[model samples]
Target: MAGYIKSPFNYTGGKYKLLDQIMPLFPERIDNFIDLFSGGCNVGINVDAHCKKFIDYNDKLIDLLNVFKNYDLNEILIEIEGTIAMYELSNTSTFGYEYYNSNSSGGLADYNREKYMNLRKYYNNIKDNYDKFHKNVILYILIIYGFNNQIRFNKKGEFNIPVGKRDFNNRIKNNLIQFINKIKSSNCEFINLNFREIEPDYYKNSFIYADPPYLITNASYNEQGGWDEDCEYELYDQLDILSSRGVKFALSNVIENKGAKNEILVKWIYSRNYNIHYIDKNYNNSNYQIKDRSKKTIEVLITNY
Candidate 1:
């Protein structure tokens, strides 16, 4: 875990913690590596491949990744620091909490609430016209200070998450630096598209890794019927197509969660005679908390070589 690069985004169901368990299972000599549901891109960024493609349905996220890939590290740091200074947001890394009369337990939320909202309003106002790099810088800054360090947008497509306790600290800054450096150097392309729309045959000698939203879990992406039974079935169908093309692929999902079994996933994998590699440890739950041992959660990596 210490050796792996972590994504700055605190994305739900991120594979950062599970990389040690997952990466070794991947093909040693991958010609092309495709991340089909690359939320936060924890897995893809760490994998070594000749070519990498990160595909996701979230256009905003893809845009942000592009910003990281296209901009210089110094430029990104400058923009982030400038935004923090401009918004009067707290920087506990530079100055301790005592500088703002706040403490770690309580956080700087009280002092940052009004300032954060103002910045959010300004970002929403110019989001359409602002420079792409600069606009995403604002969005990134917002997430740094936003609630739970999570990205959320309203129905109107506005940055709607409230101010969070944590700010852009030294640790987060370091993570961002590493992530940006990797993205800039890697032979990778980011695509915003539906997973099913990607043609499996196009990536003939490639390895695809799909970590779609788990059907049984409750997360922002899976809430409000975002992912349902039909979506699950459709994804399995796409994976089947990938198998037919002779593309080696790995899928990260849970067969059982909280005593609820994913019968559809179970039936599809077994019927197709796919390989199931059970994950010994239960990853984070819906709230990003570790699930208790009492809970029945069977996480697995279904692979087709």
Candidate 2:
């Protein structure tokens, strides 16, 4: 936990929050680390491995990581600061949760909305034109200032998430700096490919990790392209193949979430000779404060050692 680096972007369903419980389950010695669905790249970047490869279906995300690896931090920060100033937003100002609530609107809120829309439009244009540096910078800012700190794109492949109450604060800056530094220190490779396309036979002494979108849960990634039953089965099939070939892998998924059970995952895990480690996904301090706290979801880390 001391050196775990946070992903700069606040990705929904990201494994960063579960790292304390998740990290210890990884094999002590990992010659090569493979992240099959590296959404925010939180897992791969943090795992202690000799070398790492981050693969994902989203090309834009890969593009963002490429920008982080290649571009100068100062230049990226310059663009971020410029956008903040242009919006007349404060990095340290306290805007209560009510400001972001659906019911509240007036004064500075209106101005922020207008400014955010303009920035979003500019970002969409940059994305369409594929201007590498500025596009990545704008995207980063959007994550900082977007609703719920999420990065979402509309059906047209445009950045469409509305503005959030927050601004580009220190936490974001530190996370960005930490992410870049981690990339600099570690041997990392980013590839745009789906889970099935990855050939497991190519490497030895490697650990493959899959944090795919849950079939039963709803998320931003799920809406992009539905993670249906077929996709889930395909991933399981791939993992099965890897298991036969002596490839060690770990899969993070939910067994039951909000009364919706992942029957496929439940049945598959029961049938397999794998290690199932239950993860307490809740990070609520209230759970510690109050004696009786109901469990929200059942998260499990399935591993083929």
Candidate 3:
């Protein structure tokens, strides 16, 4: 196995932590690899495959990924640094926190709040006119400084996350460089599409890996009925169709969380006799970290090999 390469985006529900447990279970040799519901692409980017396709419903995210795939690493970095200079955003990676009257524990949020807002406003305004590559460049920078390093948009289709406690430090820069290099070197494609629309039979000798929004978990994507019972059933239907076509697939989902159980998933998988590999997850201080462990949570990987 290759050394783990983390996704630069702090995406919610990412499988980065579980890669150690999950990747080893994947097929050793894959002809085509499809990362259905590829948020942040943590799993897809790390997989060794002849061809890789990252499919998602978020057009903006796909565009951003395309930017990473299509542009030169140095070009993207130059634009990012130029944007930072233009916005006068804090660069704690270069200047010490003491220079900004701040510290690592407190972060540079106080100094970057106003500047971040200005940058957000500028991005929202020029997003329509800016080229796809350059606009996504600004969007990437916004996400790096955005709250929790998340990519969020409002009902008006505007970037709405607030300034985070962190800045574009050296860690993020190095991660971005590696992510871009990985995308460029691999035979990868970014498609903005819903998982249901994909035709499983078209991808022969392929292995599909799905880490969709957990029906039982509460997250930003699952809020306001983003993913519901209907979506869950539809996904199951798609996976069944893939199985019928003899396509191998692995689905990562939580059947139980915080005292709530997904009876639908349990019934479906059991009835079909799918293989369920239990995942031992101890969420701590990370994004999906659960401080209260009083309630038992069960995560699993259901597969049709």
lDDT of each: 0.88, 0.79, 0.88
Candidate 1 stretches with Cα past 4 Å from truth are 282-294
TM-score result, candidate 2: 0.88
Taking all chains together, the TM-score of candidate 1 against the true structure is 0.93
Report how far residue 290 has shifted in candidate 3, in Å.
Answer: 10
- Model 3 scores a C-alpha lDDT of 0.88
Candidate 2 yields a Cα-based lDDT of 0.79
Superposed Cα RMSD, model 1? 2.5
Per-residue lDDT of candidate 1, residues 1-305 (tens digit)? 88999999998888898889999999989879999899999999999998999999989999999999988889889989988998899999999899999898999899999999999999888847678998999999999899988887877788899999999998899999999889888899999998767675666888999999999877877865678899999989888887887888999998877767889999999899999998776444522134554466888999997
Which residue pairs clash within candidate 2? Answer: none
lDDT of 1 at 292: 57
Worst 10 residues of 2 by lDDT: 286-295
lDDT of 2 by residue, 4-121 (tens): 8999878888888889888899999899999888999888999888899998888888988988888777777778788787766554534443544422243234446777888788
**Per-prediction TM-score:** 0.93, 0.88, 0.94
What is the Å distance of residue 173 in model 3 from its true position? 0.6
lDDT of 1: 0.88
RMSD each, Å: 2.5, 4.2, 2.4
Structure candidate 3, residue pairs in collision: none
lDDT of 3 by residue, 165-194 (tens): 888899899888889899998999999998
